[model samples]
Target: MAQLAVFDLDGTLVDTPRAIIETFSAAFGSLGVEVPDAPEIRATIGLPLQRAFGDLLGVAPDDELATRGVRQYQIHYKELILPRAQELLFPGVAEGLAGLQDRGVTLAVATSKFHASADALLSAAGLRDRFALVVGADQVTHPKPHPESGQLVLDTLGIPAEHAVMVGDTTHDLKMANAAGLRSIAVTYGIHSAAELATAEPTWTVDTFDEVVARLDKALTTQDQGSAV
Candidate 1:
């Protein structure tokens, strides 16, 4: 069976913590609220914008406020944060992705970011054409940890959960993978610490993108050998 590798965009593939922090800070400043520290903003990286903003601001974000915040963030992001796309691509990310693609493994992105923004970032990072499928938060009725995004990607790729693995940097990714009955691998270099990801009980945890590729190669090799036997 053909293997499928689905990735999370923000912390997993791209190190967007700095951009996100600055954007959120600008957004909150516009709203007359003090911005939190980078670590606090980074912790909410994988969640949807509204929830992330709410968590950072320490209040329940109504639709209007959330929408405004997102807009403000986008404005700031385009002006100041977007130019850092080059810096956002983590080390070994491009090589790892190219290695997977070369192996004929289907690649896809399932992210909580908006589709257009995700596309722009991927394009800027030179990974836009790498993924055969891309599913953003706005494309699904339910977002991460809900399984819908992963399910949609699988359905779009015409692949089954058994032949796929979800790679992300957060417990939210593991939760969604578990919900979809797919194996998950968490990366230690993302926003979440190893201890936090351990709570989600991913199938594997690795320190780098190259380590992720190594683990997947091992898993696939073992499965191939087992089938031959």
Candidate 2:
């Protein structure tokens, strides 16, 4: 059986912080509200859209304003993401994914992005077929830092938590991996700084996609020998 690797989309596989921050700013602008600071908006990248917008707008997630913000952000982002999808992929991602698959690693994506949006970008990137499954916020009842999405991916792929690793750039991703009983690989080149990611205490930390692939190669080889994560 192949080991499973679960990845977060934004900040992990895709360098989307700039786009996301812009989308958030534009959404608030459309509502005639001051945009939240860029860093503050970036900090919400791993959250569900409604929650992210609500946090930035200082409203309840279920409030009409927050709901409207989600709609607006989606409109702007969907329009902006397609043409830029392949460019947004962090360098070496496609190669790293291929390497992992060659070594019998099954891949899956778990992201805070809505299902259709995630599909669009992955398809545009020509990387959709690499993943055995993709679980977006809309595809699960609960999102990151909660483990529901991670568990759903595991369940759907029939992979046990112990045989999987979750790679992500945010605390939400690491925390979800931890809660889901999977090894966590924290990547620092994304939106969150290494210092911030350290607080989550990932099983392995990588600074680039090359490092990620090398680290995984070592880890999986060792795991195949019945030791290490």
Candidate 3:
């Protein structure tokens, strides 16, 4: 049986915070609202756009203004953000992904970004076709930290939670992975620091994608050897 490797897109595989922030700022500028500072924008990295926008704009969510904000953000994101593929994939990311794929592991992406935007980024980063499944915020009713997205990926990949592992860069990812009963591995190169990620109590915390690959390789090897016993 193949193991499932799920990933978060924005901060994990691709460093898209700058593009996201600039696009959101442009969106707010269009709406005549004050643009949030970089730190404020980065803090909401893993949330759905409505929640992120509401938090950053200091407006109540589920309101008419938040609705408009979501709409405007989408427009600005497509126009301003989608074109900028400035964020490079973290070191060893492509190599690690390829290595996992070569080992017959099923890989997927579960992110809070909209499906279209996620696709665009992955494509731009040369990672779009590598994934077996892609679950986006728009694809699920409940986004991450809720486990719905992870569950959706597992269902799509026809894998059980025990055979799956989630690799991400935030407590949100760790929470979702834990909620879904999958082992979560946190990467330190993203928005959250190691200390913040520690709060999520991830199965492992890695500083680089290479370390992630190494840990995953060890886990897979152990599982294989155990099954043979």
Candidate 4:
């Protein structure tokens, strides 16, 4: 069976903590609301923009202020953050992704970021073409912790859940993967703590992107063996 590997963009492949913090600050400033500090904002990294903004603003996702915050965030993110945020791929990401491609894994991104921003940043980093598909928050009706986004990637790749793995840095990713019935691997170098990720009970947890690649290889091999039986 063909193996599919799904990834989360912000906290998984790249470290955008500064960009996220500044963007939230700028958006909140523009909207005349109190902006959350970096650590508070970091805690919400893997969630959709509306949800993150809502949490920061102490409002519901559908609240008008939250909606306005999302709009302002996109504006500032594209105009100010995107251009200034450096090519910030986490260490070993390029090599790990290349290794996965070399090993014949079908790779894709399933992120809570807007598709346009995700594409722009990936292209700027020269990593856009590596993924066969890029599923974003705007592309799905529901975001992480829901199965829709991962399921969309699997459906697009035509890969079964058993043949897929979701690699990310938060509980949201693990929860989504679990809901989709796919194995999950959590990385520690992003926003969440190893303890927080452990609550989700992922198939594996690693400290580096290289370990993620290694685990994927082992997972596929295990699947092959199980199938052979």
Candidate 5:
């Protein structure tokens, strides 16, 4: 059986606070509202735009203001993110992904970003071809912390939960992995701190892109040896 590694985008493979934070602030500013603090905005990184916007606006996700905020955010994101997509990738990410793919791990993306937006960014980053599958929040009934996106990715790719691991940088990602029955690896070099990630009880916590590769490599070796036995 093949091993699968599911990843999140913004705070995981991509160190993307600039586009995200600025777009969020732009959204609030356009609506004549005070923007949330950067840290508060950062805390919502892994959630769907509606949820994040809702929280920041102090309204329900479907409320008119939140909807407007999301629309405004989308506009800002395209302007801020698309032109410099590759530059947003975290250090060692390209190499780490190359190494993982070479080792025969099936890769996929499960992110809160909408499908069209996610694909556009990854393609612009020259990374769209790396994954066999990419499941965005727009493709699922619920986003991270709900397991819908992760389960959709796993089911679509015919990879069982046990044969896959979810790698991300937020509590939402780890909690989603837990719900989906996939072991979780929380990368601390992104949005959340190590201590914050611990609250989600990830199977393992790593601090760098290199550590993620090492852990997956070790997991595959263990799985291989167990099969041999």
Candidate 6:
């Protein structure tokens, strides 16, 4: 049985919705572009900044405006929002991670955020020690939905894709897991709806982190049984 768990950071284990919306609002405002509404910004949470800006403002990733937008967003997020914002973790996140760690399930984080930011957030939340590895979008040639990021995490962990499951809150995570030939599980209480997540056709869907533990237990059991057979 596989003993590895790969998780997405934002929208999966943590809720940064308000910070994200405000950051984008500030970024676009700085560039004199129309600020996208909360829902519009929310829809692009898991994507890279360049891509998100491209999708929302039609700014090419390499364009100077896009570069400025990303810089502005980061400035706002890091300086204004991050320090004062009360970090919000989804229910069961700490418990779920602890349970998995107790069971000897090696854990890692794969996020679209930069490595530094991901590290700071996890450390701030006291979850930095729980993961064996943390891979960010900047570390990979391609980001989520591209499979490279997830595969990089697997490679670093020395785990076979077949022996791992990816847990996240967006289609990007599911698509990346599927493309990497790994099982995927989606949680509905994050950025995307169950209906939106269903389009990615994850192996399982759950409403809570407690359900995540249960599902992993079932999968581990099934994997063990199959091995015995």
Evaluated against the true structure, the overall lDDT of model 4 is 0.86
Q: Across residues 93-174, which tens digit of lDDT does each residue of candidate 3 receive?
A: 8888999899888889999988887888888778888898888998998898999999999888788888888999999999
The list of candidate 3 runs beyond 4 A from truth reads: 224-229
Q: Which regions of candidate 5 are displaced past 4 Å?
A: 224-229
| Local error of candidate 6 at residue 153 (angstroms) | 1.0
Tens-digit per-residue lDDT, 115-190, candidate 5: 8889999998989899999888888887889988889988899989988988999999999999999888899888
Scored by lDDT, model 6 comes in at 0.84
Candidate 4 — which residues are off by over 4 angstroms?
Answer: 84-86, 221-229
Model 4, position 42, has a per-residue lDDT of 83
The lDDT ranking, best first, is 2, 5, 4, 1, 6, 3
Per-candidate TM-scores read 0.92, 0.94, 0.91, 0.92, 0.94, 0.91
The whole-model lDDT of each prediction reads: 0.84, 0.87, 0.83, 0.86, 0.87, 0.84
Return the clash pairs for model 5, or none: none
lDDT of 4 by residue, 84-167 (tens): 434678888888888889888999999999898889888877888899999999899989889999999998889999899899
Pairs that clash in candidate 2: none
Residue 98, candidate 3: how far off, in angstroms?
A: 1.3
Q: Mind giving the per-residue lDDT tens digits that candidate 6 earns over 1-229?
A: 4488899988888888777888899889988989988889988899988888888887688788888888888887787545643357777888888988898888999999888878888887789999999998889988989999988988887888878888999999999999999888898988889999999989899988888887877665355322200
Report residue 179 deviation for candidate 5 (angstroms): 1.1
lDDT of 1 by residue, 17-107 (tens): 7778888888989988777888888788888887777777666855577778888887887876567786778898899889988988888
Better of 2 and 4 by lDDT: 2
